[model samples]
Target: MRENPTASADRDTPPTEWSVDVPETAAGDGGSDVRTSNDRLLEQYRRRSRKKSAVIVVIAALLVAVWGYAVVTGPIPVSLSETVSVLSGTDTGTAYQVIWNIRLPRIVAAVGAGAGLAVAGAVLQSVLRNPLASPYTLGISQGAAFGAAFSIVVLGTGTTSGSGPILSVIDPYLTSVSAFTGALTSTTAIYLVAKYKRATPETLILTGIALAALYTAGTTSLEYFATNTELAALVYWKFGDVSGTTWRFNALLWFVVAAVTVYFTRRAWAYTVLNAGDETARSLGVPVERTRLFGMVFASFVTAVVVALFGIIGFVGLVVPHIVRRLIGGEERILIPASTVAGAALLLSADTVARTIISPIVLPVGIVTSFVGVPLFLYLILRGREYW
Candidate 1:
């Protein structure tokens, strides 16, 4: 049998009738008026919560549909069954090579990167208590971009290819490593400065902006020194396309995405408490400052790894979570996963359009997302007349 959630709360509430005339609506048919108002409101919320859960399930189904669409419709449209056959190793020849070696990896990378950015944004918004807070808001993307540029332009780690009498294939590993290091350094700088002072929203955000400006200047300097070939490569990477993702990089991206999602999802309760404000969180025995620091740092790590592999996709961390919050409520349990799936779908869809819209002259996935997000975000805000 289903249990009544408000039963215990009703029992626990003290009589309030002697103090003031109880509102007629406060009492139930059972005449249990003591806590009926609050209990009834909570029950109403529970009903709405159930509805939101159903919505989340539907959103998850949409993610699957988007994934299927991504897999089948490309430059050479492969059927879903054929794609499955290729994956299952029952198919052979050029079809398998094209799907497995190219389309599949890029699709997977797009989904993973989008999901990672969305989840990271959710975490940052909760911790920072700022609607605008995101991976980019804290300068993490710029830092990662600067690092990738350093490796690409200064070190020539991923750009020394298809030139001269002898082709030189630059090791992609060094570029990834440098990008990670630069991202970590920027994040660590923010964390350290915040810890030394206080990890308040204002302090962390200010520190991030400063670091972002520094990184941007450094990147500009690097671009000034770079040869035309190097500059072109750097610009392409910064445009945030997921076209040339190799199996090795895609594998690592998936690993990080899985790990980050699991970590954040498990800490869902802590995030809820944190969102309630520092004093309330402290009252609930949550380590407010430490939790905020961990959330920001890990979120930054995910963003860095993604930008390292896929370049600097913006507004994902900023837009997706807000969209999730708008569609679903801000309960961490639903918000995190829903944002992730929605984000994955958004990016994969954007990447698909990027590849096909202009035909051979593929646009960057980032550009597509930005073009789409700005209008959608405005619609959401204008329609609601309330911030997410």
Candidate 2:
């Protein structure tokens, strides 16, 4: 036993090769705290998504209700029951004439115009990274105004017997066509500056400002030399009334709005990426410049169509998208559609108030929207960077 010291030491020493047996829970779950935190985050996201969906549904319902109410509330009162009956083709009387001929077209125009402009504003704001970007702010509306003014003053598309709301356009088509051409001209200018000069978003806005001034000057100059009748007609046209829009015009407007809305919805993810910043978006496989340019063009096109048809309904685009963002976060997929519906509601509601606010005197929807929009725009400005 004394001679076998090595064997004795080997028997006393522990084994060098050993393996740890990790618990299945720890291996599968990583760690309990980490797993719980991940689950909480996921749940929060889902809850937020659900809340946004709920808000959208509420807005859609509001739109329908507002539409019905608008059809009923006009110069000649029509009950909701009568409204329903007329729509169902069960009764055709003064209510039918009012709903089908006058109120329906105007109300539909408001909805379509509002939705189109609002979606355009949301897209422009996202792509340009400018919370204030809108058809009115970007000079597209002003361009349309100028085009309309040109039609009235130069093209003699409008006429008036006396200085009153009785002013009428001789050829609505020519006026709209002229307005579209003007809007296209302004859009083209912006595109060129963006493409050739490599303008920033801020620069493009400045270009818009300059174009607006140019168009305004042109319009003012035309008004200066116009006859009294022409002046009256021009002034009324700038008020932005949907009361005069025909069914044909509404059809065209809704078609454009629907098509543009679809395009925006499909490309919403791209817009969300763009909102993250141009460089970040580029890194994420987005064609930054092309997307920006196309976004501006499409947004401008929809805006142009609406303005051409309904004159200039301001702040529907600017105010609506911001309101939607506050409700749903910066998720464009929801933001675009929600803004569209919300915009329709806002404008329709405004139009309804405009009709009844003064009883006999119907205020221009443009005026009402401005009254609302100006305060909100100022508030957003005061809120500074956080508003976005």
> Candidate 2 lDDT, tens digit per residue, 1-388?
5677764678778567768733333334557775666666777988989999999999999999998788889778899899889999998998999899988888998899889989999998888777878887778888877887788788777777553664566676787678777877887787688668867766887998999898888888888999877776667767787777788888888998899999989999999898787789999999988888888878877887777666788888989999998888889999999999999999999988998899878887888999999999888888845844
TM-scores for every predicted model: 0.80, 0.83
lDDT of candidate 2 vs native? 0.83
Weakest 10 consecutive residues, lDDT, candidate 1?
Answer: 160-169
Model 1 error, position 94 (Å): 2.7
Q: Candidate 1, after superposition: displacement of residue 189 in Å?
A: 5.5
Q: Whose TM-score is greatest here?
A: 2
| lDDT (Cα atoms) of all candidates against the true structure | 0.79, 0.83
lDDT of 2 at 193: 82
Give, for candidate 2, the lowest lDDT window spanning 10 residues.
Answer: 21-30
- The alpha-carbon lDDT assigned to residue 312 of candidate 1 equals 83
Clash numbers, per candidate: 0, 0
